[model samples]
Target chain A: MALFFRLEEAVSDLIHDGDSVAMEGFTHLIPFAAGHEIIRQRLRNLTLIRMTPDLIYDQLIGAGCARKLIFSWGGNPGVGSLHRLRDAVERGWPNPIEIEEHSHAAMANAYAAGASNLPCAVFRGYEGVDLAQLNPNIRTVTCPFTGERLACVPAIRPDVAVIHARRADREGNVLLEGIVGVQKEAVLSAKRSLVTVEEVVDNFGPRSPNAVILPKWTVSAISVVPGGARPSYAHGYYSRDNSFYVKWDEVSKSRESFLEWLRLEVTA
Target chain B: MSYTSSEMMTVAAARALRNDDVCFVGIGLPSAACNVARLTHAPDLTLIYESGTIATRPAILPLSIGDGELCETALTTVSVPEMFRYWLQGGRITLGFLGGAQIDRYGNLNSTVIGDYAKPKVRLPGAGGATEIASQCGRTFVVMQQSARTFVEKLDFLTTLGHGRTGRERRELGIRTAGPQLVVTDLCMLQPEQDTCEFIVTSLHPGVTREQVQQNTGWPVRFADTVAQTAGPTADELAVLRELNERTARAHRSDS
Candidate 1:
């Protein structure tokens, strides 16, 4: 009753060409390495959604794997520069990337609604802003009881959700010990889910019941990939290479250099 | 008299910040400056970030503004719109910390294009929430290394306008934000004159001459009649910053 595989194999089967995939992790933590490998396979026209896209997203976009992306910010880690995504937007490459400029929580709420089989969620956060003008997908719906106009964000049920965690068992019981945000909702909202962890235990005996971030029932495939959040530091595996990030920013300034760098760092 | 570029920038930023100011802090330089203020002077400063964190107080410097570190220690986390509309546009925010690819004399920023908007020679990172923050915040503090290429006479494209045309024109247009209040660089700190949008040297770091500041600027940089000496970072300030970085690196290492 347990499904297990390597990182690459797990992602290869979970993702398909043109599938809408939601990835967990922000900036540089717990990004699905197996999911990245799936992108390296040249899965074309794929739609990727994240709270914020970083180097991995840029690589996917550059590789022609991603046709569209939805996120709040896409850029080099610290410098707050997002040249790759900007160029694609300006040149109108890979079709116009639909941008949903909302907070990470708002996007998670939309996914939560989808997981709960709801049409939309009324959020009070976006009351008076031009974010409505940017997305156009979100609409104003009147609350039945209060008669107050609230922004109704549509559900986002991605075809696949790929997440990387600290530890897991053969049966896909995941333990994410630190900050737990929208990872649970992301797994539930997706039709199928893949979990890649730093280590795989024989069973879920070592972890306390409360420490389990995702239970086995929600996960379809599990992969044990040591150092899974490569380029991005795994929380306890290694310190983030600040020097590497600085170098990446310098190289990513130019389009040609960035493409070559990605091909080498990500694909190989 | 000696300070790292990051430390010097932080000192300049800390001095520029006012009490009860709401600041949209970018990562790196902005984070250092804001945290320094929190530690020393501006304890009531409200920090709003694009990551939806409000009034963040990280014990150490965050790896990035969007890192869970910010959210974990933040006083409150709201949706992105509330940060922009209610806090920013509603004029609750007083200052914005910005770093840019290029800046013009009028304080117009160019994070978008290098040549033209239609067919840009180099397409820079398109404006994120910076456009809104610059336009709506009560005042914006720009931090960049002083250089001719960055301090252009006119920007390739207006990614964020500090003053629509000029200080006079900005007033005429009824712009809400007071526009770019101060420009802090590694060499010196510059401020826009009251009636004109032209930047004048307000303070120079030790060993940085007025001529050096002017030479580095792209426009006809003016100097204040009485330019003051920029205070160097104290031993305590430098120690705290280094300790923060070391702790953050250690935390990441242990977690990995």
Candidate 2:
């Protein structure tokens, strides 16, 4: 059964030092509040994983929380670069965070493989690409059945997974609508999962076409944090704050500005 | 209508898509081009986003690939894994449209880093879906502004494959797709040479010179035997493109 807790309590209880964390969201329903809570609690040495590793990772990484980042893309979405993430990789401002990059296809397959209890994900990718030269993890395996060779990457089984959803039933079943990217697989692939919902509702009401429901038993805990996915909108709850993303380009430009912004954000 | 060279890039890229094309759209220039094609000539063109939004017809442009408008407007949305595995790798996408920071003569792209991968002067967003999109699609089209910086003699890193320089044919290397057949840029349209797979100027945008194209590309550029002048953007195309862009600006700006 899934338990309900406040955001802080859940972050403290679920996340720890040296844990591999995946805050999975494509460009929507990103759990910004939970990421901030992890920052506030000062969790350290995390192997953070995500497909995009957008703004939240920027914050977590800029705050000196991450030991390594396993990601495909690290940018500010429609905006340009994630300055803090760039700083960490290029100059090691906060720390020299190690990086293990993959393509989107590989990350998606890896997460699915983790959820399926598979050792590695096999796919037809990285053909004629130079990515395999840089990353040792991208290797090839021959299919015994067809004598065809395919690319393989180890499964991404994280220690903890966090996400923000549109709603959760009183029974703790979470509902995610619109741009539901690897959240379900991330949750299932993790040892523990925490979800922050916009509200706890009596009924899920009617769902649109692109909605997903995570039943109670699949989740470890639920935190009802209204507007938890702000800046990175929670579908029906709000719009993505495009201005904030534009502002982040400036705020994250310099180390001093990032720290000052972090101090304000953490204190608030 | 007097369209800017930047608009010419988008218009030229959009013209590449046919009515029956199932385009796997990238963000930025590719997105705008794909949407413009859909609204104008290729109304039946299917726009697939990496966010799992398949057959999306957004009223306005999406800043991010998976913006609310993309999902809500999509015919259907799958999980990211499914989107990549079934729709992409399963060989359903006919065209993969992309943009990049740097491109080489062989048509390989570099969006990863501007310097060494280990120690970078400038770090860029690594490969998202570009690798598979470039590899698995039936064909790929790259839309980026023409410049010496982007059209480089050598890439800092190759994030996606087009065609290997000499010995490594993408087909011979077990990649079945026609990788990066065309590159639509601000100044001219580049197509791969039949023998070398090196990008060569096939058509120059109106009022652009062969010398201008050579200056923009880093390599000692080559031109097609019969290099043709590109048709200017039609009045109707410009009107629709402008409307789409204006609506997108409104939606994005108002949200802030």
TM-score of 1: 0.69
Task: Give the TM-scores of the predictions, in the order they appear.
Answer: 0.69, 0.98
Q: What residue pairs clash in candidate 2, if any at all? A: none
Instruction: For candidate 1, write residues A1-268 as lDDT tens digits.
Output: 3677766777778889999988866443546476568757878888888766777676677566777787655567565555566666666554445444544435756777877878776554342233444557767787799876666777778999887777787666787643344566678889999877788777756555556367788888888787777666555554455555556676776778886776776777
lDDT tens digits, residue span B183-240, model 1:
8999988888777777788899877887888888898888889999988888777766
lDDT of 2 by residue, A113-219 (tens): 99999999999998877778889999999999998999999999999999999889999998877788999999999999999999998988877764678889989
The window of 10 residues in a row where model 1 chain B has the poorest summed lDDT is B77-86
lDDT of 1 at A148: 65
Docking class of 2: high
Model 2 stretches astray by more than 4 angstroms: A206-211
